[model samples]
Target: MHRLANPTRFLRLCNMVKPWAMAITLLCLATGLYFSLFKSPPDYQQSDTVRIMYVHVPAAWMAMFCYSAMALSSAAALIWGHLVAQLIAKATAPIGASFTFLALITGSLWGKPMWGTWWVWDARLTSVLILFFLYLGFIVLHDAFDDTSRGARAASILAVVGAVNVPIIKFSVDWWNTLHQPASVVKLDGPAIHSSMLVPLLLMACGYTGFYLWMLIVRMRAEFNSNKIRAIRIRQANR
Candidate 1:
């Protein structure tokens, strides 16, 4: 990690990995979509409407996972003054935000058919909503200051603070009486979901994760180039 901390090295590594990551993301998405749309069986209860879980559950997972990554990177930035960590957190924000939005939209879509409502203030839903706001807040705070370093520091603090919500989002169904269903795929005893449904759901989750990595690497490379250009321009202005 330290060896790849240099921006030039990071850019080179990203260039090398980008094509492979993009390929894998596409492949996984294709296979996953086939499994999700064609191969998977409908839920005994919800019927066709349960199909939304493939997209909604994975997006919700990524939303939490991405924010957790950001928080860890932000902590590294604050404690170790790691520029790459800060860049990673910065690069991950919009992607995480998009995942949160997808989760919310798809959850709402799934809800209307299953729950007979488009929205709810249930603990699970509300916590995920708060997660979305945290992402938005991180973006806004990161750009709010004239001094970029100061802004980054402030955003890092917020990221770390907001991280407390991740676990809440994950366990909200268990912790509170809510409209949301409890865990099906991940549980202490074993997966409650049937193998037929679980396989497609797992594939879709992996696809979403790969997609996030592919986008994150691209965004990080662009951000590194933008910073380099800004530095060069500043040097020219000084000269």
Candidate 2:
């Protein structure tokens, strides 16, 4: 991590990885969609509505994944004073929020047909809603101060603290009576889901992961450039 602290080296690395990330994202999403929409068998109960799982499940997973990334990055920034880590946490906010929003929207759509309702206050649903708000809060807190460093510090602390929600969201269904189903793919034994559905679901997850990585690099690059420009302006004003 420290080795890549140099802005030039970091940017060079981003340039190298960006194209591969994009390629993986495109390939995986295309293949995943094909398998999910065309090849995968429909659920006996949910039927066509089950197709929405491909999108909703992956989006939900990515939402938590992104928040975890942000929390780790924020911790590094606060503990080690790594500017790049700070920028990374900052860059991740909107993307994480976007993923959370996607999850919520898709989940609602899926729920309407399956549960006969558009919303629920079940443990999983409520906790995920809280997670979404946490993302928004992080973004708002980060820009709330005139002193950028102070704002960053405040936001980083919030991120680290809010990370407690991730696990709560994960375990909510297990811990409480809920409309949400228990874990199917990720389990102590093995995936309860059939290979037909599991394969495309896994593919979609990989695609979402690649998309997040690609977007992270792009956003980090933009954030880095913006910081540089801000520094230059400050220097000019001082001069």
Candidate 3:
């Protein structure tokens, strides 16, 4: 982890695996979509519309996963003053927000057909909505200060504080009455979903993960360049 704090080394690592990640990402996506749309059978109750689960569930899971990553990275930044971790938290914000948005949109589309409404104030849905707001709040706070350190610190704190929402989002279905379904794929008990459906769902989840990693590397590179440009400008002004 310490070795990766060096931007050059981190970028080199990213470069080394980037091609493989991209390849795997594309492969998984293609296979996943084929299975999701064609290979896998529809739900007994919901019929063909159940296919939406392939995208909606994974995006929802990734949205929470990304926030957990950001919160952990933010903790590292606050504790060890790891600049790379701070950059990671910063870069992760938008991607997580996008995933959350996708989840919400897809959920609404599915709900409109199944639940007979486009939106609901269900516990799980409501908590996930709060998660989206938390992402935006972190981004806003990160840029609210002129001092870069202050901004990073503020965002780190916010990320840590808001992490409480992650669990709330997860358990909301179990803890309260909700329109959303309970855990099917991940549970202490064996998966409730069929093996055929699970295969495509898992593949799509992996694809989403690969996509996130690939984008993180690209975004981190841009962030490093921006920092260099800012430093050079400061030096010239001082001179």
Candidate 4:
């Protein structure tokens, strides 16, 4: 992690790994979609509509996972004063927000058929909505300050603080009676989901993970370059 403090070396590693990440993302998406839609047997209850789980579940997972990542990055930035870490957290906000949005939209599509309503104020749903707002709030707070460093610090603090919502989102269904179902893929007694559905679900989750990595590296590089350009312009102005 400390080695990654050097921006040039970090950029080099990202460039090397990016192509492989993209290739794997495409492969997983193709295979996962095929298995999820065509090969896997539908849930006896939800039948065809269960296919939305492939998209919704993974997006929800990524939304939570990316926020956790941001929180950790924020902690690192605050502790070690690493600008790279701060940039990572900043770049991650939009992607996490996007995944959160997908999860909400897809979950709504899944919910209407099963629950007979387009929306509900369920615990899990509400907590995830809070998570989405937290992401947006981080972005808004970051831009609210005139000094970019001050903005990053403020955003980092919010990211760290908002992490409390993650567990609430994860356990809300179990803790309260809700329209959302309890854990199917993750449980102490092993997964309750069938192997056929599980395989594609895991594949899509892996693909989404790769997609996030690919996006992160690309966005970080862009941020680094932009910062450098800004610095150069400042130097020229001072001269």
Candidate 5:
């Protein structure tokens, strides 16, 4: 990680990895979509509506995971003064926000058919909404100050503080009486969902994770290039 901290080294590594990551992301998305749309069996209870889970659940997972990633990167930035860590946190915010939005929209879509309502103030839903706001807040806070480092530091603090919401989002169903269903794919005992459903769900989850990585790498690379161009302009101005 330290070795890759240098911008040049990071760029080199990204160049090497980008093709493979993009390829895998494409493959996973294609396979996952096929499995999700064609192969997966309908839930006994919810029928065709349950199919939305493949997209909704995975987007929800990525939304939380991306924020967690941002929080960890923010922590590293605060402790180690690593610019790459700060850049990663910055790059991840919009992607995570998009995923959160997808989760909410898809969840609402799924809900209307199953729950007869498009929205609810359930604990899990509310907490995830809060998480989405946190992402927006981080992006806003990071750009609020003229001094980039100061803005990054402030955003980092907010990211760390917002970490509290992640677990709440995960356990809200268990911790409170909520309209959201309890854990199905991940549990202490085992996945309660049948294998027919689980396989497509897992594929979708993998696809979403790959998509996140692909976007993150692209965003980070663009950020690095922008910084380089800024540095060159500053040097030219000085001369």
Candidate 6:
């Protein structure tokens, strides 16, 4: 871990990882889509509309996963003063926001056909929406100040605080009456979903995770380069 804290060493590791991440992302997404669209049987009740679950459920899962990762990274950055951890938290925000937005849009699309509404203020839906705003807030706060460290600290604080919403989003349906369905795939007894449906869902989830990793490496590399350039400019100016 200490060795990886060095930016050059981290970049070397990322160079090795980026290709594998991209490959896994492509393979999983392709296979998952094929199974989700053709092999898996549609829900008897929702018919063809059930196909939306393949995209929506995985996306919602990724949204929370990414945010949780961001919060943890932020905490690490603050507690240990890890620059790479700070970069990771910064890199993760936009991707997490994208995932959250995707989830909300897909959720609404799925909801329309089943619930007969395009939107709802239910606990699950509302909490996820708050999560989306939290992502945006972090991104904004991180760049709001001219002093970059100050901005980063502010954003990190926000991320750590906003993490409280993750549990709420996850348990919202169980805690309160809501239009959203309760846990079917992550139950204590094990997934209630059939193998046919579960396979593609898991595949898509893996694909999403791979995609995040690929993009995070790319973004972190860019950030490291930018910081290096900025440091050089400051040194030359002083000289």
Poorest stretch of ten by lDDT in candidate 6? 1-10
Candidate 6: tens digits of C-alpha lDDT, residues 1-239: 77887888999999999999999999999999999999999887899898898889888998999999999989999999899999999999999999999999999999998999999999999999999999999999999999999999999999999999999999999999998989999889999988998999999998998999999999998899888898999899999
List the lowest-lDDT window of 10 residues for candidate 1.
Answer: 1-10
- Model 4 bad stretches (over 4 Å): none
Q: Please, what is the TM-score per model?
A: 0.96, 0.98, 0.98, 0.98, 0.96, 0.97
Off by over 4 Å in 6: none
lDDT of 6 at 189: 98
**Would you list the clashing residue pairs of candidate 1?**
none
Off by over 4 Å in 2: none
RMSD versus native structure for model 4: 0.9
Supply every candidate's count of residue pairs whose N, Cα or C atoms clash at under 3 angstroms: 0, 0, 0, 0, 0, 0
Q: Write the per-residue lDDT of candidate 3 for residues 90-140, one digit (tens) a residue.
A: 999999999999999999999998999999999999999999999999999
lDDT of 4 by residue, 122-233 (tens): 8999999999999999999999987888988999999999999999998998999998999998788999988999999999998999999999999999999889998998
Which regions of candidate 1 deviate over 4 angstroms? none
lDDT against the true structure, each candidate: 0.91, 0.92, 0.93, 0.94, 0.91, 0.94
Q: After TM-score superposition, what is the CA distance of residue 181 in candidate 2 from its true location, in Å?
A: 0.5
lDDT: which is higher, 1 or 6?
A: 6
Model 4: colliding residue pairs = none
